[model samples]
Target: MKSGSGLKDRLVAQARAEGFVDCRICRPWDVPQVPARLEAFLRAGYHGQMEWMAERTHWRGDPAKLWPEARSVIMLAESYTPEGDPTGILAHPDRGAISVYARNKDYHDLVKKRLKRLARWLIAEAGGEVKVFVDTAPVPEKALGHAAGLGWQGKHTNLVSRDWGNWAFLGSVFSTLELPADDVEVDHCGSCRACLDACPTDAFPAPYQLDARRCISYLTIEHKGPVEEELRGKLGNRIYGCDDCLAACPWNKFAVAASDMRYAARDDLNAPVLAELAALDDAAFRAKFSGSPIKRIGRDRFVRNVLYAIGNSGLTTLVPVAQALTDDPDPTVADAARWAAEQLS
Candidate 1:
């Protein structure tokens, strides 16, 4: 414990070297002033089918509400910026455009592995117990990031890092350590309506609020049933998450170019042909997306996304691909296939 360097600075230097793009600290007592804003967002049903976001309002706004004994929050951001606009692949009607974030690997697993390593290092130095979380937990990571000066919450309601753009996935560790809190960031989204203007479904009801029910990412990946009919055609070649909002942000001009080789582009995922993807059976789907984040969404949902992409392909040639999936055992896939076939005809 006699390292002359202070603990927090030592930890920050260790984290940056461990492939984490940025790390900042916050006291556990300081959850953002997210109560009214979160309550309003929830009350308005902006979270859509993410029912859990509404179920745990207490902890979502205040870390103290989650674990009162926790003394510090170590917030981390990992950048997943792609080399180019992911939407460029959309013009190839025969291709499937997986969101840049999901193409290479499951971030939850990747981030958790690194966070645990960091936590272990913390324990070795400070002898404190710790718990870590990626997006799966109730921890308000975006709020913690804002408090720690990593970034501010942009109007799109995603944390915007000056160094990482909006392309970062957040993770946090709630620990018993009493690390000093870092500086906080202020919102700089002033007068920029780029995110609002770029949304295809007009999901933003106002500058800062999002209506997830109309969001393509929610509709394609999270929503279980048939996608809202009117919005299906707008989904385009996107078979997974939408990046329009993040890509349109002017602040991305200053975004860091990632050096993580693990996050580098994979040829198959960069722009997969829609016809080839739409025909995948369960076995083929598993093989193709083996290490990717999309695998967790499962074959049915993956095929459902493929059907949505096919419907938006504007090519009559893909009707056969839809016809092949119309009788899929998973009803969601079958339903989407029928919709796509009709759209093509």
Candidate 2:
């Protein structure tokens, strides 16, 4: 027999009590009619340099094969809504707009800690084992979240919760205990193409599908080398990730303030001076971004991005800064700086 308690309510209450902004439960199964949907997404090469996305097509969309023993999936969301609209920073060309996710220390560490504790509690109460996932997993977490009624997948393709807006970082807690599934929420994006029109690079070719090849987030944070020359200026001062699509959603009005303190904006990260970031040596870069997710990009690539921003800044004052990186050991950094110096000169 299943546990006497109503597992859904108990888990939801437990989630809130554990400081998760919201939680929802869903059955572990194949995404009905999503194989071709995914095949189309891959066929269009929407995943870009994220080769792993296409490599594990089988285990990604279905949770059952990921862990055959899993009976229920608990999808939890943590909000990182900013104190103010981040879009305002775009006008300040000299300042690089770091994506809100990297504004604080990494969420993967913070959310995983909370998820493990929550999973432990569930196992203790229900007398079973559990597994936890935070972003890096074979499971289609956003799809599972949608199935669990956590939110609908917006046109931007990121899960958008009615309560948290599009400012959520997702984590999953898979368990062996059987839990009643919640009603899956239907898409609320009906007739609203705000996100589709708002993207600077127009990353989305169609509704609910993202061609990550053109996504600024993928370009700055994921892609390596001399980011497409034509797309360089279009990147503006958004040195990290782009959020124009997420910010344009009308549903974001319902968002509450950030629930995780780590997700809160750091004064230093909110709008970093491109000139200052461009000057960071490896030691200085590590010292400054230690424990922050931005550190993962390293000084060379990070500086390369800053050089591109400085070029777009059109601020002649940053010319000397770009010229200084002219002879740097890293070819990418040097090329970016040279390009920026030429443009800014």
Candidate 3:
């Protein structure tokens, strides 16, 4: 088996060849602070409806506890920087704003395939047991990414890289082979509260902390029922996920477009008209969002979000679109339609 600095160098080279922008290694025990932070977040009910965070606290909080046999954690960064300003779409009330990340193909599918390829190469070259994970697992990927020197968890609580900024997807590879860990990154967000102040719904309670319940991303994607009445107005035209805080990061000036074309924004999804999106039936919704991450939210919940955007749009032309769904089979969708109609009326 190839072991040492030579093998580590080869691993990084292979990762780049596989299209990862950055790669680094860290031990499973590197993120000792995760457990306490997670405990605080869960205790404060900041996780919102994500009960999975509490279900596997032991594994989610500590990587060493997740798999003791794993000697090293390989963190890979895949950049997906949008070609244009992701926040600009919010100004066009007639258009619905999808988060930059969801404007293309699902990162989970793309990143997972890349991780598996790296895992296969590692097994062949380093001859060790390997397990690959994207976002599906309970792994503390952002914490591990910081520990691996890929980036630090910025004030936004998202992994922010000096080289890639905050517009990257993270994947982890656990291995039995021992590898040299990189130096941990320190926070560089000195006196910069841009991300905190940029939030439309005031999701951040303080630097390095976030309240998911108040986040537009959580409201549009994760929250099951209709969103809180007060918060719905703050959503604006952002129907899928919100990127205001991410776009506010100053470090993005140094960021580059994704090397993978799959991450590029789709033409249809780029500032899609709210009336057209709200009119999509279940079949059309699935067909339009096929192979996209937005499909996970399903049509009913998706239309519910569009209704919120329509209400906030003030585009009286969308009244009939909202009126048509006033009797939607889904109660949440029906309630959203009524609310949107009231706003437009």
Candidate 4:
């Protein structure tokens, strides 16, 4: 127990040195509420087309089930808070509003690199097997994060740190070492419904729950095929993940800007013209967003999102661009283009 106590502090120190904004530990079984909450989310079909969420339900809802050998779950956060208002570009309908996180390099690569560094150090220090994961895993990161005292899950269902707000990316390191666990963070959301009210698509069925099928981020980045026509106009100019709920958080007043310049929004991505993004072919899209998280969505889905933005822009001049894409090779992009051109007409 004495060695366990010492190792916990060392791990936290190492994580901070690796540029993690915050780090905390919890036992694998700390998140008891996850099973019921996740089951309810799945039963309600809130995961939308993310079928992977259902495939690993047992492991996702119970960290103990994920790897029985894991004794400690270390949850870390790295801030990506934008220097300016993330939602400011939404008003400029002619420009795309890529989520602040996606405007820079892909966080999976950046955060995983830091997590691996910490994991390697942990193995050397405590001689325990470790596995690191970013958002790619089915791990209930936010639930474990709340249990680890990093933050409480806010009304938006995203982890909200009193110190770092919701503008942070989460990563986890599962270790066989039995480290001392931190006290859990209780809900600090109180009466604030700012995040709930800020949803442009009404994605939240209630506070603390989200219907991803109706979410702009899911539509633009994850959902394939034609977007539900009714929701396209509400997408406004957001061409990637949406940040409305995170930007609406009142807790941001206490948030600090990210220390890593890798998260700084790129000038080109900050306010890319709708017509320009709408014109990117597969190769051009790849070249433009090679290292960006947005590249994962591919040109077809991305152009579909851009068409939605162009349709919502109310700029008749962009009608021709939308009309030109009406015959795009990708059926979804063509569907979106026809809808956009029709919206303008």
Which candidate should be chosen as best, given lDDT against the real structure? 3
- Give candidate 1's whole-model lDDT: 0.85
TM-score of each: 0.94, 0.97, 0.98, 0.98
The global C-alpha lDDT for each of the candidates, from Candidate 1 onward, is 0.85, 0.86, 0.93, 0.91
lDDT of 1 by residue, 91-136 (tens): 7888887777887878898889989999999999888788999999
List runs of model 1 lying over 4 Å from the truth.
Answer: 1-5
Q: lDDT per residue, candidate 3, 227-290, as tens digits?
A: 9899999999999999999999999988867988988889989879888998899999999999
Segments in model 3 whose C-alpha atoms lie over 4 Å from true places: none
By TM-score, the better pick of 1 and 3 is 3
lDDT string, candidate 2, 4-56, tens digits: 44766787898888788899888788356556778888898888788888877
Spell out the clash pairs found in candidate 1. 94-274, 95-274
When sorted by TM-score, best at the front, the candidate numbers are 3, 4, 2, 1
- lDDT value, residue 45 of candidate 4: 93
Cα distance off (Å), candidate 3, residue 87: 0.7
Each prediction's total of clashing residue pairs, residues at least 3 apart in sequence or on different chains, is 2, 0, 0, 0
**Tens digit of lDDT per residue, candidate 4, span 291-320?**
998888899989999999999989999999
